[model samples]
Target chain A: MAEIRLEQVRKAYGGVVAVHGVDLTIRDGEFVVFLGPSGCGKSTTLRMIAGLEEVTSGTIRIGARDVTELEPKDRNIAMVFQNYALYPHKTIYDNLAFGLRMRKMDPAEIDVRVKKAARMLGLEDFLARKPKQLSGGQMQRVALGRALVREPDVFLLDEPLSNLDAKLRVRMREEIARLHQDVGTSMVYVTHDQVEAMTLANRIVIMRDGHVQQIGAPLEVYDRPANLFVAGFIGSPEMNLIEGRIEGADFVAGNLRVALPPGVQASGEVVLGIRPEHLALTTEADGVAFTVRVIEQLGAQTLCVGEAGGERMRILVDRVDSWSPGQSVGVRFPAAKLHLFAKSSGQRVETAKP
Target chain B: MSSKATIYGFLFVGLAVTLALIVAPAVYAVSLSFYQMDSFVGAPKWVGFANYVAVLQAPEFWRALLNGAIYALGSIVFQVILGIGFALVLNEAFPGRNLVRGLSILPYLLPTVVVILTFKWMVDGGIGIVTKAVEAMGLPPINWFESPGAAMASTILVSVWMWTPFVTTCFLAALQTVPQSLYEAARVDGTTAVQRFFHITLPMLKPILTVVVLLRAIWMFNKFDVIWLLTRGGPVGATENLAILSYRHAFNLFDIGGGAAIATISFALLSVAVLIYFWVFPLEDD
Candidate 1:
């Protein structure tokens, strides 16, 4: 295992910059995931690290070697593409043995490694089958096995599970997590799915518009997002950001007003960020009133989309709290859970501890 | 039910047209091989298998068949190799790639007669630019059409030059359909450039390669225009092929039965070759 360091790496296509200067250090055996929406340059950064794309600027070092100018084959890295990218014409055994053969390994040793990988992936019975004969999940396994057989220093996965169905994606995700644990190799994974990042990454690098927005542990990034983008991107059902003005001691928008958390500095226009789960239905008089537009009952938790303070907001509540559409309810945002951001820049506004 | 019937009715008309235009002529030609008709006006005398026996016994016919094989095989080998090589190069991303691709297809689009005439002028023994250039390079002036081997080689060379682009275009189109991710994966797998071509590119191109080779083989085997225009089976029948021989027999020698027999033999040989090809290289993946 080796640490991967990117010193202000940047990539551009013609005049269009796809990845801005990104400086990151992934420690040995650490599983760092780059998470963002499409066209956010997360995949581009991953490919650059794999040496599949040339770094237009800055340097990338894997272990003690600078691989900035190296070809992908010379980088001593293995990557699993989004589509599995298995050789369709070759059998599973050949696909797994391909890298070993390319390295000029002995035939006996190649066979041994191929068998081991196949056994690990439960593909022994399908060793002679071509990729076309395999199911989506089986193909994914072959892809993972191909990388596993290489025994490279760093493993790069470029949205490898994106092509599978929902149930298969979850299974493959779990398999990848177990594989990382078993191999203990430094891996850099890129995906637009936040859930995958939240579950798989030891440290999550949230990106937006070719820029790294936040880098922190999954819970840390979830609990304390760096900005408006991270706050909205990290969580499912999304964080609710209600635009309003901060008066003397109260935040007011439209016909709604709620007391700000103590010592929350700055006034004028601000966006109040609160996770859906942080908002609660209450009968208190100090709560903001909401008109529920739609109710989505998701078994364990019920999500309600509603209008609060003249802005659309999502509130996640326990399934026990039954609220129908058109119901007018009072929602409370506890002081500890409130996230306030400057409206003009979307940067977080620090609040003093109470 | 009515719509289905209408579709079948349209299909029936198409089948009838194909049978009348294509199948009928082929059948009539094969039948004519069994007759001794000299001209269209005279009644055909039943000759049984005498015409077929004559064609098989004729040393000129056998020599012509051998020349045809050599031309077809020679042209096909060069065409496929250069086609795939050019295709691989053109598939790479470069500036003005579309313009290059458009220009590369010009050879395949030019009329066969024009290509033949152009090649004849360039390879003309006297006052030809190519001959003069070769002499300037300190090489003896080469006769492109006079000697038997030289004539066959020039015919093959010109055929390859004109048709390689067609194969290239076919391969280039097929190459585009191969997913780029496969190459990226192979590269990451530590495959060198040569290995990538053999393992990834070649295998992915197998189905299309087989089809192009089969089509070019058939077309080259039956080709008459290029040979007729360039050498006209000249220099003592050096470049004579089955198609040219059949034409000579029918038009020049006026041996209608013998010409029909030769044509029928060419068709039979081609059918056997196609059958063997299919049997040896079954297209279906294992």
Candidate 2:
């Protein structure tokens, strides 16, 4: 296991910079994820750490050695790409043994490590089959097996499970989590999927436009987002942000007023950030009014889509919540679950009043 | 149901007509090869293996066949290697790359007759630029097309130059279809540029290269115009190829049976090569 440190790392393609100057430290054995939207430079950052991409102007120290100028093989890192990137011509056995064989390990030792990885990934039966014969999930396992056989200091996965179907993505996601627990090696995963980041990462590094928006444990980042970007990106259904004036201890938008916590420091206009499940439903008299547009009954929970201040808003609720389209209902936040940010900067504004 | 049957019947007839249009000439040639041209006025009489016997016994026919093989194999080996190399170079981004690619295909587009005549004039005996260049280098002037070995070398050289561009074009088109992600994967696996070519690019190019090489081989084996124009089977039949020999037999010697026999033999050789190619690399398997 090795710690990774990026010091003022920047990557530019021509005059257009893909990765801005960023600094991060990943402790040994930490499963850190660089999560962002598409076109964000999360993959670029992970590739830099793997030495697949040249560092424009910074040092990438993997475990204590500066690998900024090293080749990918010299850096001793293995990466699982978004497409699995398995050699289509080689059998699963050959694919898993390729890195070990490249390192010139003894033949018997190579066989042993490959078998162990295959057994761990449950790929013993498919060892002799080419990648074309295997399903996407099986190919992903071989890719992971290829990395595992290397026993590299850092494991870099570039959205390895994104190619699988929905059910398979979940199963493979859990398989990755299990693999992490079993190996305990440092892993840096990059993905546009928040659910994968939320579940798979021991520490999440939320990035946007190549900048590290926030880095902390999944729940830590989810519970205390650094900015409006983090607030909206980490949660499914997304954190609902309503722009309005924070007049004293209450945030008002048009005719809707959701009271904020006491001593809230925002004056004029500010954005109200609340998770969908945190939007509590009540009788018409108790809270801010909501007219439901669509109700998605997801068995245990329902997502209510409605219009508020000319923008569509989503509210997650238990499936038993009774509401209909065009019906006015009161929505409230329990103060402790609510977040308030500055109107312009999007920085969090702490408060104690509601 | 009656209308559908009529449509199907009409489609079958059309297909048969198309097949017959191609097969009739070949069938007639085979029939002609079985005869002896005893007289020019009457239809040739059946000779029963006499034409094949005469062709096998003739030293000129045997020499031409050997020269053709040398030309075909030599052209094939050089074309595939240099074409793949040139294709790799063109696949990358270089200054004036579009112009470089366009110019590489220039030799392929030139008329075969013009190309042959130009090279002939440039390499003709003493006044020829090629001979003069050799003499200037303090070496004895050599009669290239007048000697068997030199003629075969010239034919192979010109064939490689003319056809390698075709293979290069094919390889470049195939290279474009290779997913960039595959290369990135190779790079992350610590594959160097040379290793990536062998491990990733080459295997991915297997299907296209098969088609390209097969076509080039068949075309080179059947090629007539350039060889005929330059050598004309001169220097005591030293460079007589199947195409020129067949033409000389039917038109010059008026030996229609022998000409037909030579054509059949060439066709058989080509058919066997194509059959072996399919047996080795099936399109459906990949």
Candidate 3:
């Protein structure tokens, strides 16, 4: 296994820059996921590391070798494309053996590796089957198997599960996590889906507009997002960012004013970030008053969207709680769970007692 | 009336037109091949298998069949090779690609007579560009049409020149259908450019290649106009294909029965060739 490093790597098509200078180092055997919305340069960064795209500037080093100018095959890296990209004409065995054959490995060794990958992927019965003959999940495994048989230092997967259905995606996600564990190879996966990033990545690199928003462990980024974008992007249903100002231990926005947690500092325009699960529906009088707009019952839990301080805040409640639209409710944010960001730059602001 | 019945009523009209225009003439030609008929007028006399026997015995008929085979083979070989080469080059992105592709297809769009006449003028011995160039190169001011082998080569060359664009167009469309990601994947998998073409491009183009070859083979087998317009099946019948031979039997000799017999025999031979081709390169499982 080798550590992959990129120092100020950039990509441009003519005058339009797709990826700015990006510097990152993926530790040995680390599963790093580049997560972002569409056109955020995450895939471009992954492609650069795979040597599929040329870096406009700076150096890319895999272990001790500077592979910025090398071809993908010469980089000793394997990539699974979004479409799976299984050779439609070749059988599963041939597809798995393709990279090995390209490297001129011995036929016996190729057979052993191919069979081992097939057995691991549960594709033993599909050795002779063509890609078109396999289902979506099976094809995904074949793609994974093709990459696995290469035994490369780093494995690059570009949205490998986006093409599968919901149930299949979850299943494949777990399978990929298991494979990563079994192989213990360094992996760099790219996806727009946060669930895949959170579930599969040891460290998630969240990007937006050709810039890295944040990079940390899944829950680390979730609990303490680096900026407003990271705060809004890392959670489902999104975190509630209420634009307001902090004045003398009170946070005010529109007609609502709530007491701030003690030891909080920096008084000026700030945005309060609170996740849905962090808010609780309570009848306490000191809680922020809200008018419920909608309630979504989700089996064990229920989600309520309510208007609080002229902003829509979503709160997760128990399914047993009977809440209707237009009902008045008091929502409380735990003092430790409040995230404050500077309104001017959207950067996270630290609030600690001096 | 119900919608189903209305749809069937419209389809019945189409079927009737096809039967009258295509099937009826084929049936008439088959029936006429077994009888001796005169173009001038009179009832055709039933000759049983005599017309077939006479055609088989004729030396000119055998020579014409050989010429036809060579012509078709020569044209197809050059057409497929040059067609694929040109299509691959044109498929790449470059400045003025649309204009180049449009110009390349001009030969296919031009009237067959125009292309034939142009080639005839260019290859004429006197005041001909090709003949002049040959003389300038210290070669003989040779007769392009008077020589047997030269006439056959010339006709085949002209056929390839006029129809290669059609093959290129078909191949270009087929090449476009191959996803770009497949090539990217192959590159990552360590396939060289040549290996990618042979392994991915060629296999992906198999279905189109089969259809193109099959259609071009059938068309070139019975091709008449280009050969007739260029050499008139002449230079001692060196360029006389089965289509020209049948036409001459019908018109020059006014033996309609003999012409029909040759046509029927050519049809049978072409069918066998097509069948063999399909057997050798079966279509992929759907």
Candidate 4:
């Protein structure tokens, strides 16, 4: 196992820049997920680390060796592509044994290791089957088996589960997380799906455009995002960001003003972010009244869509509550749960904990 | 008769005439092969397989069969291999690629008569540029059309030159179908360039390669025009193939039965190839 480090890594294709000056350090045996919107350069960053892409101008270190100039083989990294690129002509055994065969490992040893990997991936029965004959989930496991048999210093996965159905994706996600636990090898996974990032990663790196938005523990970034983009990107329903202004010590969005705690420095133009689940409907003082637009009943929980003042919002209301469209209701969330950021730059404005 | 009945009667008459124009000739030739020269007015004597036996035993017919096999083997192999090599080079990003591709097709697109005439001019006696170049290089000048061996070699060369680009076009289109991601995947797995070509590119091209090779083989086997212009079954029948042999027997020999017999044999050879093709690459399970 080895720690991977990137120092000001910049990748540009002719005139277009894909990854702009990224600096990150992934610890030994750490499961780091690079999560972002599509074309956000997170996959590019991961590929650069795996030595699949050259650093336009930067250095990458795996353990103590600077592997920036080395080939992918010399870098001792294994990568699973998005489409599970198992060799279509080769059997599952050959697919898993390909990297080892290139190294000319002992045949018996290769057999043992390949079988062990197959056993772990539940693909022992499929060793003789071709990739085309396998299901999407089985092919995904074969891809994982190919990576596992390598025993590399770092494992890189590029949206490995995007091809599978929802249930299969969940199963594969857990299988991957468990594989990491057993192998104890450092991993860098890239995906646009934030839920996968939250469930599987020890630390998540959020990106937008060509810049790194934030990097921290999944829960830590959720609780305290470094910027508005990170906060909006890390959550599923996507954090609701409304344009607002700093009026005296409070931030005001249209008719709603969130009164700031004492001694808090306010920016001129700011944006307010609050998770839908954090906001609740209650007949309490300081709660805002909203007109219901739509009620989506999700069995035990209901997702209510409404307009608070002129701002449209979706709230996750617990328990079965009947609320018709155009009905007036009061909604409130803890004041500290509200996230504040500068409107121009979208940088988070630090605030006291709730 | 009703209007519809009249139209139907006219359509049947037209269909009969079209069939007579195309299908009647083959049937007439086969029937003629069985009859001897005695039936010039009514129906000739029924020889029954004697013509087939005589044509099969002829030395000229056997030589033509041998020449036909060599031509098909030589031209198809050279065309496919060279065509694929050129297509691979063209598939890459390079300066002047469009110009190179356009220039490469010049030989394939040239008319058969023009190609044959150019070769003939380049290899004519001592005045020919090729003959002169051979003499200058201290090599004996080849009697291209006079010597059976030399004539066959030249015919093969011209045929390959004329058809190679056609095979290249098929290969180029097939090469485009190989997904770029497969190559990337192989690269990441430490597969060398050669390994990637063999293991990935080659397998992906199997279905297309089979089609190109089979079609080229069939077409090259029946080729005649260029060989006729270049050698005309030269110096002891060195360059005679089945097509040329059949034409000569029908015209020069004035033996329609013999000509039809040779044509039947040629047809049998092609039919055998088609059968083997089906056996070797049957739809999917194979």
lDDT of each: 0.90, 0.86, 0.90, 0.86
Model 2 native-contact share: 0.43
RMSD from true fold, candidate 1: 1.8
Candidate 2 CA-lDDT value: 0.86
Highest-scoring model, DockQ = 1
**Between 2 and 3, whose TM-score is larger?**
3
* TM-score of B-chain for each predicted structure, in order: 0.96, 0.89, 0.96, 0.87
Residue ranges of candidate 1 with Cα displaced over 4 Å:
A309-311, A320-322, A352-354, B1-5
**Docking class for candidate 1:** medium
TM-score of chain A taken by itself, candidate 4 = 0.97
On TM-score, the stronger of 1 and 4 is 1
- What residue runs in model 4 are displaced by over 4 Å at the alpha carbon? A284-286, B1-25, B37-44, B125-140, B283-286
Q: DockQ, per-model, please?
A: 0.75, 0.53, 0.71, 0.50
Where does model 2 sit among the CAPRI classes?
medium
Worst 10 contiguous positions by lDDT, candidate 3 chain A:
A345-354
Ranking by TM-score: 3, 1, 2, 4
Task: Provide the TM-score, chain A, model 1.
Answer: 0.96
Clashing pairs in 4: B39-B44
Per-residue alpha-carbon lDDT of candidate 4 for residues B1-286, written as tens digits (9 for 90 to 100): 6999999999999989988996798778777777664323544677889989998888888888889999889988899889889899988989999999889888887899999888888888958899899999999878777766777789889988899999888888889977776787777788889988898888877787888888888888888887788878776788888989988877787766777778877878898988999799764531
TM-score of chain A of each: 0.96, 0.95, 0.97, 0.97
Off by over 4 Å in 2: A307-312, A352-354, B1-20, B38-41, B125-132
